[model samples]
Target: MKFHLTVDNWTVQKTDARAVRFDVFVIEQKIPVELEWDDMDELCIHAVAYNEAGQAIGTGRLLPDGHIGRMAVRSTGRGQGIGAAILQALMAQARQRGDTEVVLNAQTQAEAFYGRYGFSRDGEEYYEAGIAHICMRHVFA
Candidate 1:
């Protein structure tokens, strides 16, 4: 399936971005509504992927400090490269901002996926929002 991505601040694409995050994180993952959102959103650089039909299917964000978070793709959009596109877009944004490395607390199950993108484990696994996650980083070469 064909999809497009938009990289912008939260305020500019909040509606579409929120919908994708809400469906994946809030609804499917059962994460607490409160924990799913934070002040960081307004301060981070957001990347949202839209289907050919114009529906938001994936999203991610890059913090000012080069931390990547809130990476998500709706169930229907999994395995279609939407997540990779979103991550690549955010990584590009980080590099454009002069960041040498970008970090993320990836769900342990996804460690291999991130690894394929040149991300390596940075620390021991830990639980966040009740899910097992491990710190990972990709340093631009």
Candidate 2:
């Protein structure tokens, strides 16, 4: 069945966004709460995606330094374009703020996903929160 979804910018404290990230990162991915919740959240621009039932199913954030992180889409929401929508929203926010480039530490498994959006892997593989990751960057022309 097809599902309808909506993506919107929200404050860092928005509960919907927090809930989505909590489920995807902390619970599903086994990331520690301390490492998952950080001071940078207050200094970042956040976005959340909601399904037709108004349930938040995806989330992401763009930091002041042009770093995109905490990207997550609920298992039920995968393959539904929610992740792409969140990424696009964050990138638009960066472009509007005059950022010349954006970067993210993509979990190794997701490198190909970001690559589809013009992000290129920039460095050797590394581990963050016990998961393999690679730095990826997208330069705006």
Candidate 3:
């Protein structure tokens, strides 16, 4: 499958990002609708992945403070590097902004996925929106 990515502020890509997040985090994961959104979106940089058909398949964001969150890839797009590409794009954005490190509260089940990209566990596991998560960090070299 072929796809492309777009990086911009929420103002430019909120619709696309919101769709993927709504599907993955809200409907699919059963996370409360209210908990899936926050004021930070407008202030953060967002990235959305579009498949060959132009459907939004994945999305993620990088905050000014170098925190990464809301990473999601649609079910049909998984295992094809969509998630990795979204993550790398956000990390590159952080580096371009001169951030020394990036952090995220990764769902425990996906810890190893982030680990493959050099993110290390920073604290004990905890729960977020009823899902197990842990603090993870990756320092830029």
Candidate 4:
């Protein structure tokens, strides 16, 4: 099936971005509400993906220091490239801001997905909010 996905940059405080992340991270993944929301949110540049019907389907954020985080795509949006679109949008924002590198703590299951985007595992695996994760980084010239 094909999907008409639109990714737009927004502040983390935006409702659309918050909705997507809440569904994917907190509700679906069982991440604690406390851990799902953090102070860095206010300082990051966020991207929210919308479907043809104008529903938020995915989200991601890029911090000023080049850290990418809070990437989430709703269950209904998975396997349709929405996640990749969100990541690309954030990466573009990073590039436009003159960032030389981007880093993220990726869930172990998603290491290969980020790898396809040139992100390499940077350190040993660890757990965050009860999920196995590892640090990954992508450098730009």
Candidate 5:
């Protein structure tokens, strides 16, 4: 199914936009519940992509420092460029917020995907809930 990506402050719709993506990431993918959510959620802006039926298939969030997180696309919907769309929307929103650098804790396996968007690794890899992750940053001057 195809999707329409939308960027919005999580508050405008709150959990309404993130529920499904979290289900895939936190439950289906086995990412720890604590790792899936954090205190920053309420303070950050969110980006969501809705499939034709209006269900969210992809989602991500941008923190105050322009760090993006929770970038997840439903397993059934993977390999369809949804993740790229989510990242693009989130970064656009971050730029609007006066941020010139966009950052994210990337799942090591997916670092290459982000690299295509001009994001480069910032430091050594680390373990987050048993999964390897690394800090990546996208800077726009």
Candidate 6:
């Protein structure tokens, strides 16, 4: 049940190389190709996790504006706390940068998952790429 978390710039770019995991959660999951990739990559910090075999099992990215998104743990790696570890890693990076807050767009189904990290929903649910989504924000307390 113990998972190690690491945060670094462009780390995910190396381990999650092809970003196939992202394509699974973002593009293949129909989360709008636009939302899948943005200009943020150039300025964001990425967190990537490696399993016992040294393969990328989970990943996430944090933007300079405190935007935490594009997080995904390979399906096989689920239920091992990798997603939360990735989020926490990015949050730590944000804190190191003196960010006072963080924001993310949560798919309706995962809202509760993000809520555990102190994220609060800000608006009504809306459809994006045929899936329901809501804006969520988290502020340091």
Q: Pick the candidate with the highest TM-score.
A: 3
Which structure among the candidates has the greatest lDDT?
Answer: 3
RMSD of 6: 2.3
Q: Compared with the true structure, what per-residue lDDT tens digits does model 5 show for residues 1-141?
A: 678877777676466456865678778878777766667878888888888998777788888878898888887678998888888888888888788899899989999999999999999999888889999999987
27-141 per-residue lDDT for model 3 (tens digits): 9999999999999999999999999999999999999889999999999999999999999999999999899999999999999999999999998999989999999999998
Model 1 TM-score on a 0 to 1 scale: 0.98
Q: Cα deviation in Å at residue 139, candidate 1?
A: 0.8
Per-model lDDT: 0.93, 0.86, 0.96, 0.84, 0.83, 0.78
**lDDT tens digits, residue span 1-141, model 6:** 444556666634744723645656665685656666666676778887778777777878888889887778777788888898888888888888899999998889989999999999999999877879999999987
Location of the lowest summed lDDT over 10 successive residues in candidate 4:
1-10
Q: Predicted candidate 1: what Cα RMSD to the true structure?
A: 0.6
Q: Please give the distance, in angstroms, between residue 74's alpha carbon in candidate 1 and its true position after superposition.
A: 0.4
| Regions more than 4 Å wrong, model 4 | 1-13
User: Could you tell me the lDDT of residue 47 within candidate 3?
Assistant: 95
Judged by whole-model lDDT over C-alpha atoms, candidate 2 comes out at 0.86
Q: Model 4: per-residue lDDT, tens digit, 12-51?
A: 3478888888888888899988888778777788777777
Model 5 residue 131 distance off true place after TM-score fit, in angstroms: 0.4
- Residue pairs that clash (backbone atoms under 3 angstroms), model 6: none
State the number of backbone clashes in model 4.
0
Q: Which residue pairs collide, candidate 1?
A: none
| lDDT of candidate 2 at residue 67, scale 0 to 100 | 98
Residue lDDT tens for model 1, 60-139: 99999999999999988999999999899999999988999999999999999999999999989999999999999999
Output the better candidate (1/6) by lDDT: 1
TM-score for predicted model 5 compared with the true structure: 0.91
Q: Candidate 5, which ten residues in sequence have the lowest lDDT sum? A: 13-22
How many collisions per candidate? 0, 0, 0, 0, 0, 0
Better of 5 and 6 by TM-score: 5
Give candidate 2's total backbone clashes: 0
Cα RMSD for candidate 3? Answer: 0.5
Q: Candidate 2 has what TM-score?
A: 0.92
